[model samples]
Target: MLSGNTKFLQGVQIYLLSRDHSNLKSDFRHGNGKIMVNCIENQPAAELVLGKHVFLSVAEYYLRTKTG
Candidate 1:
């Protein structure tokens, strides 16, 4: 997460407000659980896994902090 003073982490709900999903995913994947992803979008990133009709981008599963 490249925010001012916020640290992003897995399992943490963030409001992604970017149109650059590819860049975000790439940044998140570059680190080995070191990068935090934060979203300021109208939708919550976690909701993709919590709600119906959710669509996950490529490599999203690997970025998830939790696995069930």
Candidate 2:
């Protein structure tokens, strides 16, 4: 997990990363680059809360995969 100064900003970072990862190719070709850039501009509080839930979901997935 992130710590200290980074912890505060991690959620927004994750949201942007998740949004970009979902919408754009690794190379970021075509129009998705614009959408990715736009989605990251606002940084809403709700998205931060949602991002924390997403982190929990990811941890659960990894734990289940490891156990099974």
Candidate 3:
């Protein structure tokens, strides 16, 4: 039942979260952190698009949990 904008935002959040934590290495942090940091550093446009999506997903989750 999400609106178009809401859906787009959810998608973007999913994408960003995936990129941020997709690769897990050791407990001390190594390659995964670097990969996410590099992505944020190199791709500004993508980050902007990603930032929009994060909030909406949280909102949607809140709504669903509240009602259920």
**How well does each candidate superpose onto the true structure, as a TM-score?**
0.30, 0.23, 0.28
lDDT of each: 0.37, 0.42, 0.38
lDDT of 3 by residue, 1-68 (tens): 12455545455455556653323223114532222322332333332312222322566557756875
Q: 1-68, model 1: which lDDT tens digit per residue?
A: 22343333222423333336665445444643234333444423332321111224434444453453
Q: After superposition, how far is residue 66 of candidate 1 from its true place, in Å?
A: 11
Task: Report RMSD (Å) for each prediction in the order shown.
Answer: 10.4, 9.4, 9.5
Per-residue lDDT tens digits of candidate 2, residues 1-68? 23354544665466556665544333333532222222434443332222222333476557756876
Top candidate (TM-score): 1
Model 3 off-target regions past 4 Å? 1-4, 21-68
| Model 3 lDDT, full chain set | 0.38
Local error of candidate 2 at 58, Å? 28
For model 2, where is the 10-residue window of minimal lDDT?
A: 46-55
* TM-score-sorted candidate list, best first: 1, 3, 2
